[model samples]
Target: MSVRDLLVLGSASAVPTKARNHNGYLLRWDGHGLLFDPGEGTQRQMTYAGVSATDVTWICVTHFHGDHCLGVPGIVQRIARDGVEHPVDAVFPASGAAYWARLRHASAFRDTGVIRERPVSGERMPLDTGDAPFRLVARRLSHPVEAYGYRLEEPDGVTMLSGELAARGVRGPLVRRLQQDGRVTAPDGRTVTLEECGVTRPGQKVAFVMDTRLCDGVRELADGVDMLVIESTYLDEDAALAAEYGHLTAAQAARVAADAGVRHLVLTHFSERYRAEDEPRFAAEAAKAFDGEITLVHDLDRIAMPRRRTSGGGA
Candidate 1:
């Protein structure tokens, strides 16, 4: 069966605590594994999360911050070490090309030439992923440094209405033909169109926003997405610090989700100032703004994507 989920490798922000490591998250969507914001100690964290270097299909870095891209060298080296045949795409801000080059060759090792550089430029743009099942887009974010966010959107499709099909006597092979050809002949010599027996099903969407203050890009990326993985670096009490450092507080993150109609809100990238006992406070603050599912993640947590919305229903 196909598996779609987010694997939390690490959740700490700039500093690492005994209970948390630097930032790292892996999104597994069927055959594609997108590794996002891999910070220091990501290799070890991946091992603990049961993720191998070969499983990574893409590495998306929001910025050149050490806590976001420091693990590039290790992951790249490990990819070469494992002799992963598939090409791994490395995506980041185009302005950070110099930093990426340094991290790509941080140490002397055999270069397998399997990692491809696909930097993101412009304010907002769709990335080329060949024939991937979903469309991937990048949008510029508000931060001291050049940062970007990513969104994955699947194509909308139609689901067959069993009741309609049975009523029309469109059973067995006729059902498949109706879906493929858009029309098929029923048992009573009647022609039935696909639209008459199917309802439009909106595609599933997920977004990743890291180390960015609230901005238009954040709203655009989170709009109606089924899952939103965002940074909540400070509490509402320290909103000033959050704005100064170009980050979001738990309440701010939740409000964004509520505004964008996000179904599952994942709050991560917490500061080290908060302790294990304080974790509940983050969820509590977020609950006031977002009534949907909220997850204050810990290292090695695996979160499943919300199920697809029912026909004619909102996510």
Candidate 2:
């Protein structure tokens, strides 16, 4: 069976508290595992999350910040140690090439050649994944440093309606042919098009917006996505601090989700200043704006992607 979920390995901001680690997130989509913003202790956190280095197909770094990319050394070494034969793509800002090189070879174990470097440079460039099921694009975010947010969008396809197929006497190989060719001849000598038997199913979209203030890039990434995992580093009261630090408050994150029609909003990368007891306050403030599903993540938390929207409903 296909699995799509977000595994929170670490959820702290710049500093790590006793309750929260640094920043790390693993997004399992189908057969691809996208590890995002892996900070310190990510290898250990992966062990706790029941994921291994081999499970990671892509390592997406938003910036060169220590809290975001510090774990690259350990993760790369682990992947080499574990003999991960598959090519692992590393996506980050092109300007941080030196930082990525340092971390990638920081005391390398065996130094496998399987790690493919895909440093993004432009404002809205799509990472080349060949024939992957989804298109991965990076957009520049408003941060103190060179930062980029990632968005995965599956192409829209058609879902064959069994009832419609049966009504048209389309069955067996004809159904497959109709899907592939967009039209097929039935046994009754009738030609049926794909639109006649299938409904347009909107593709699933997910965005990762981390270490960014309120910017157009954030909105573009969050637009019409099914799930949005964003950085909510501060509460509403600390809006000034959030702005100064190039981070988002819970209210700001929630308002973005509401405006972009995000079905599931995951608020993470919280500052260590907030206690565990203050977590609910984040949800409460976010609820005032976004009415959809909201999750305030912690270490080792697993959040499944929302179900696909029905036909005619926007993704």
Using all chains and alpha carbons, the TM-scores for the candidates as numbered come to 0.96, 0.98
Local distance difference test values of all predictions, in order: 0.94, 0.94
Name the weakest run of 10 consecutive residues (lDDT summed) in model 1. Answer: 306-315
Q: Which lDDT value does model 2 have at 69? A: 94
Give RMSD (Å) of candidate 2 vs. truth.
1.1
- Summarize candidate 1's per-residue lDDT along 1-315 as a digit string, tens digits: 778999999999999899998999999988899999999999999999998998899999999999999998999999999999998988999999999999999999999788899999999989998877788999999999999999999888899999999999999999999989999989999999999999989889999999999999999999999999999999999999999999999999999999999999999999998888889999999999999999999999999999999776565
**Cα lDDT of model 2 by residue, 41-67, tens digit:** 999999998999999999999999999
- Clash tally, candidates in order: 0, 0
**Which pairs clash (backbone N, Cα, C closer than 3 Å) in model 2?**
none
Highest TM-score against the true fold, candidate = 2
